[model samples]
Target chain A: MSLDFLAGFTIFMLALIMVVSMVPGLLAGLESSGIDYDAVAYRTGVILVEDPGWPVYPPWEMNDEVHKDEIERIGLAVSKDTPNILLSTKVETFFNDSFFTPDDYRNLAIFGDIPYSYHFSLRSLDGVTYNEETGDPLPPGYGYIRRVVKIKEPGVAVINGTTFAPQYTSLSSNQEFIVRLDFGQLLDPSVGAAYRIDPRTEPVNVTITNFGAYLNMTEPSTNATLRTVTFWKKDPTRPIPQFTRIPFAYGTTDSSLYTLTIDGNPYDLTPDTKVFDNDNISLVLKPAATSLFTLDQNSILDIRFNFGDTPSQTNITGIHHYDYNSTNVTLPDLQTGVLEVAVW
Target chain B: MVNDAGQLYTMEGVAAGVIMLLTVYIVISTTSIYTPGDTHIPDMQLEQLGSDVLAMMDTPDTNGTKSALETFVNADDDAGFESMFLSYCNAKASGAADDLHMSANVTYRDGNLIKEHQFLAPDNTWTGRESAVRVTRWVQLDSQPGRTTYAGARAQAVLVEVLLWRA
Candidate 1:
C-alpha cells in the first residue's frame, strides 16, 4: 500500500512540471514572428549593370592582305582601327571536386528561380571602369558581382579562377549556410564581363636576352646591314613546350624577365623593343643601350618579336634581361628554328 | 475527462508516425538531385556562330612596314566579334549556357600562316583550358566554346581549323 501511494505522488509531480513548462513555450511560439531572411541575390552580388567594356586586343597580322582580312574577321573598320594587342595562351585548368553537399542542393533551389540578366557598356581607356548605369566607378576592374564562387561549407566559400576567398553566407531560407553565385558576366556573346585577354594583354617587360644586330655599327654582315638580331629566353611557365624550358605558367614579374644575350652579351630590355606578348606585333622604338647595335647612321630600325605566355599573355612584365658592357657583347646559343635571317 | 487525455496522447503518437513515413518517401524521390544529367541541345546554333567568327578572319595585305600578323586581324568586324564573344562570356558567366569548348593552334612566320591544327578543349576531366586564347580586359578563355549549365546536352561544340591569311 505504501509503495503504490509514493508512485502516484511522483506521477502527479511530473505532470504538474510538464504543464508549467508548456505555458511559456506556447505563449512564445504564438507571439514569435517568422524568419524574415535576406534573399541570396542581395547578399551575393551587386545590382546588375551594363557592359563593363573589358579591354580587347585589336587583331593584327603581318601581311597587308591578311591584315585586311583579319580586320574584316574581327568585324572592325580598317580606317578606324586602333593598335590592339593580343596575347595567345595555352592554359589548362581543371575544375576537380569530389564533395557535394546540402548547399549544392540549395543551388538547385535558388539559381533556377532567380531571373538573371546581364548588361555592359564602354569604359574609358585610362583604366577608368565605370558602371554602364549611373556612370559610377566599378572596383577598378570587375567588381565583386557575387560574394562567393564555390561553396565549401556553411558560411564559407572560394573565389572562382582565383584561390582567394571572402566571408559569405546565404541570407535566403535563414538556414545560415554558404552561398554560391557566379557573377562573372561573359563577354558579349563572344566576350566576358571581365577583361577579354587575347594576345594583347601581356606583361611588356619581356627582354631579348640574346639579340644582336648585324649592322654598320660594328661591321657589315651577311645579315641585314641595319639588321637586328634579338633572342628572347623562354619563360619557365611558357604555355607551349616548343617555346619554354617548362610547359607551365610562371609568375608575372619573374617570367616577364627575359635574359637576352646579344652575341653572348646581356642587355636589359627597354620599352622601345616593340616586345609585347600578343598575337599582333608592330611598333618602332629608340634603343635604350646600343651595345651590339649602333644607333648613329641607322639608329632607327623596325624590330618585331613576340614573347608572352608561350601561347598568350602580352601585358606581362620582368622578362629576362642580358648583361651589357663596354666590350664585345656575347650571346648564348638558342635554337633559332623560327628565326629567318637575311639582309637588305 | 481521464479517457479524453488518453486519446489525446494517442493522437500525437499517430501524427508523428505519419511524418516519419513522409520524410522517407521524400528522400527517395529526390535522390537524383546530386547526379548531373545532359540537356542534349542541337548543334545548329553553335555551328552558325562558329562559322561567322571564322569567316571574318580578314587582315591587311603585305606592306614592307606592316606586321602580317597584326594586319590579318579584322578591323570592322571587331565590334561584331566582341559582341559575340561578350555574349558568350555572359551566357557562361550567367550560367545560362553550357560549358562546351573547342580550339586550334597556329604558328606564324614571314607574316604568313604556316602550320595550323585543331586543339582539344577543357573538360570536367581536365585541369586547364585547351585551345584557350588570352584577350585584353577579358583575361583568357579557351579557344573552344565555353560551358553553361544544363540538365543534359543542350549545347554542342564543332571543331574547326582555319589558316588565317590575306585573301
Candidate 2:
C-alpha cells in the first residue's frame, strides 16, 4: 500500500511540473499579434484613396489648427464620383505633417487599438514633385500598397494686353477692367467635379501682361495709376439685378485672401500706385476670400481693376469673361503620379 | 490508522493529477483561439495590390484621354489587358518585379439579366487549390454598336473583376 501511494504521488508531481513549464509556450502563442497589420493597412489605403472624406461643405483641407477637430477624415480624392483623382489642394494639406501629428493620423486616417508605424509617399510620374511622410526606416516585413493617380490642377486665365488690347481699350473715362466669373456657368452639373473649375475651392488667377499695349498712347505718361482693386457680386434671383460692392477689409493686405502683384512687386489689392508700361498685373483670388463672400451657385463675382488717374492713363475697360475659352483661361492637363502607403 | 492514511493519500494523488490535466487542456484551447496562424494576412495584401493595380490601370495618364482599361475593354482586347495588369502588379519601388498571376472577367447588366464576359483565362500555373483573391473596379464605357457584352446603346458602368494569386 505504501509503494502504490508513492508511485501515484510521483506521477502527479511530474505531470504538474510539465504543465507549469508549458505555460510560457501557451502565452507565446496567445501573444502572436502579427495577423492584423495588413488588414489595417488596406483599410487605411482605401480610406485615403476612394473616399472624399467628411465635412465636404467647408472642406477638410481648409480646417486650420483651431478647427482641426472638425475634420472627421482625411481623404485625397477630389469627390465621391471620382476615385484615384486627387485635388492638388487636398494633397498639399494632407502631407503637411507640421499641422497634423502622428496621433491625428492614427485616429483620423488609421484607426486601430495598437499605434502602428506608417510611411506615405507620393511622386509625380513627370518628376514634378516628390513628397514623403515617414515614421521610421521600414523593416523587413510590412504591409504596403501602391496606387497610380491623376491630379487635377486649377486653371489660370492669362490675359495678354497685346491680344485683347484693341478689343478691351475704349475711349470711356472709366478705366476699370473687370474679370467676370459666372458661377452658374462654371459650376454646371454637366461638367464633372473632377474637371470643374470651382472658384469656391480653387484660386482664381487673372494675369494681365504687356501693359504697354493697354496703356494710353495718347497720354503723355507711359504709366497708369491703379487706384484700387475691388470685388463686386450680383444675384440674378434678386428683384433688382445690379452689381453691388462686396464689403471687405480692403485696407488690409492679406495674402490669404488675395494677392496683387504690379510689375512683380507684391502689394495690397487696393494699392494706389503707378504701374509702368511692360509691367504685368497679376491678381490671384484665393478660396478663403471667396468663401467669405457668401455667394450662391448662380451669383456672379466680379474682380474689378480700377485705375483712378486724371484723364485715365490706362485704357483697360470692358468686362472680360473668364470662361473655358482656350484663349481666356489655360487649363493644365491632369498630371499622373504614384502614391504608396506602408504600415508596420 | 493504516487504512485511513492509505486511502487518503491515494485519493489526493488522483485528484491532483486530474486537476493538472484539466488546466493543460483549457490553456491549449484558449491559446489556439488567439493565434489564427496567418491564414488571412496574405489574402488581404494580395487583394489590395490587385485592386490598386486595376484602379490605376483605369485612370488615364492625362485628362481628356481614354484610360488603358477603357481601351482594352472597348476593343475586347484580353491580351492587352492581361499583360498590362501583370506588369503593374509585379512592379516594385525597388525596380524588381514580383511573381504574380491573374485572371479577369467583366460583369455588366443586360436588360433584366446579369452577364459576365471572361476577359482573361488563367494560365498553366493556376490550380484548383491555390489561394486566390478577387478585386473589382467600375469601368464606364460608352455604348458600342453590335457589342453583345455591353448590351446597351447608352453609357454603362461595368464591374471589372480580377482574380489574383501567387505561386
Candidate 3:
C-alpha cells in the first residue's frame, strides 16, 4: 500500500531525472575506456590463491646408484671384458662435394691444414683388408667396414680396446684421412665437468679427453660401393641403472590395486599401498636409488603409473633449465597427480 | 544574503558530482558484462604470439630444451607475462631488420632460481636476495656496411635474468 514500487521513492525520482538524461553520455564514456575490464575484475575480486609446496625430486634422486657432485667415468675400459679392435668404417670418405661446418671449412680454405679434419680410420681391418695369406680382395679403394659388440661387464672405456676400423684405399677424392678420436671415454678429470661409470661404485668420475673420429673411406677403387655403417657411443661413461622412487596411489575400495614402477623394476604395492594406520603414510623406496643408468647418458629409469578406477599412467617429466642444468629426475606433485620419477 | 554568483557556483559543484557518480555507475555496469569468460582478444593472438617467439628462439620440439622454457611461460596467466618474457623473440623470423624490444631473466627464491637457471653466459652475479640474468635478445639497429654480421646487429649483447629465491 505504501508507494514503493508504483509511485517510486524520492531517490528513484531523482535518479530517473538525472540518470535517464545522462545515459547516452555515460555509454559513450564507457565505450571509450578500452580496458580489459574482466581481467581487472577477476584479479581485484579474488580473495586468495592457494599454492601447495611439494618436494619435486625425492623419489628420483633417492637411488643409492646415483653418482652426484663428482665426475663419473664411462667407456670400454681397458680390462678383461672391454672390447678390443672391433670393426669400424670410414664415415667421411666422399666424392667431389665435401661440405664442412663453417669453422671446419674455413680452416681448410684458409690454411689448407686439416689438423682438425673430422675423420677416422680402421684400427682392425683383418676382415676387410685383403690379407695376402688368405688372398682376399684388398679393401675397395674408397670404402669401409664396421662391426658391433657389447660389454660383458662394466669398467673404464677406451676406443682402441673394443672397436676396430676397416681399411680403405683412396680413390678420386682430393684428400683421404682418418682421425682417431676416443669416442668411448665418457669423462675427463682435467676439465672436471664430471663423468661417471656405474656397476663400479655406482659411477666413477671421468671425462672424455679423446673422442672417436669420422674415418675417411674414400678409396681409389670404389667410387660408388655398398656402404656399411656401424655407429656407436664414443668412449662413453657407463653406469648400470638403479631404482629411485616407488610412486603409489590408491583408492579406498575393494578395487584398490595400483601399480607404480621404480627404476626399471616393478614391485607389488598391494602390501605397501594398503595400510590401516591412521598416521601419516610415508612411502619408503627399496634397494636405495643409485646412478645405475649412467651407461647410456640418454637412458632413464622407466616408471609406469597405474591407479584408481581408471587407468592411471604417469611419465617422468624432465626437470632441466637452460645452461644445460637438469635434475636428472622429475619428482611428481601428488596434488597435481604428477609423481616423482628418475632415470638411472 | 547569498550572492547570485555563489549560488551558481554551488549548483555547478553539485552537478559535477552527480555527473561523476552516474558515469561511474554506468562504467561498472558495462564492464560487468566482461568479467567471466574473458574472450576478447582477436583470434589466436596469444597462441600466435607464443609460437612466433618460440620459433624465433630456435628451440627444439623435444620435451625439454627450448621447448621447456616456452611451456613454462604458458603456465602463467595470459596477461601476467605479456610484457615480460612473452615478447622476447616475437619477430625472430622476419629477417634481421625488424626491431623488437624484449628482456628475459630468471625468477629466484631462497637464493636460487625458482626454476634452476641453466642457460650459459659469460658473466653471472648474485648478491643476497636480488639478482638479474642478462638474456641476450634482439634489438633493431642502424646497419653497418662490409661487416659480416652474426645473427645480425638486430641482436644486442644484452641480458636476461629473473628473481626467485630470497635468503
DockQ ranking, best first: 2, 3, 1
**lDDT, model 1:** 0.23
Each candidate: chain B TM-score:
0.24, 0.80, 0.23
lDDT of 2 by residue, A178-270 (tens): 999999999888777777888887889999998888888777568998888999999999999999999999888888788899988999867
* Candidate 1 to native Cα RMSD, angstroms: 26.0
The candidate, 1 or 2, that scores higher on DockQ is 2
Residue B45 Cα positional deviation in candidate 3, in Å, after optimal superposition:
8.2
Greater lDDT among 1 and 3 belongs to 3
| lDDT tens digits by residue: candidate 2, B94-143 | 43467999899999888899999888999999986889999998989987
Clashing pairs in 2: none
Q: Residue B32 in model 3: shift from native, Å?
A: 17
| lDDT at A142, model 2 | 77
Taking all chains together, each candidate's TM-score versus the true structure is 0.20, 0.75, 0.20
Q: Which runs in model 3 stand beyond 4 Å of their true positions?
A: A1-344, B1-52, B61-136, B139-167
Higher-TM-score candidate among 1 and 2? 2
Model 1 interface DockQ: 0.03
DockQ values, each candidate: 0.03, 0.30, 0.04
Which 10-residue window of candidate 1 chain B scores lowest in summed lDDT?
B35-44
State each model's CA lDDT, in order.
Answer: 0.23, 0.81, 0.25
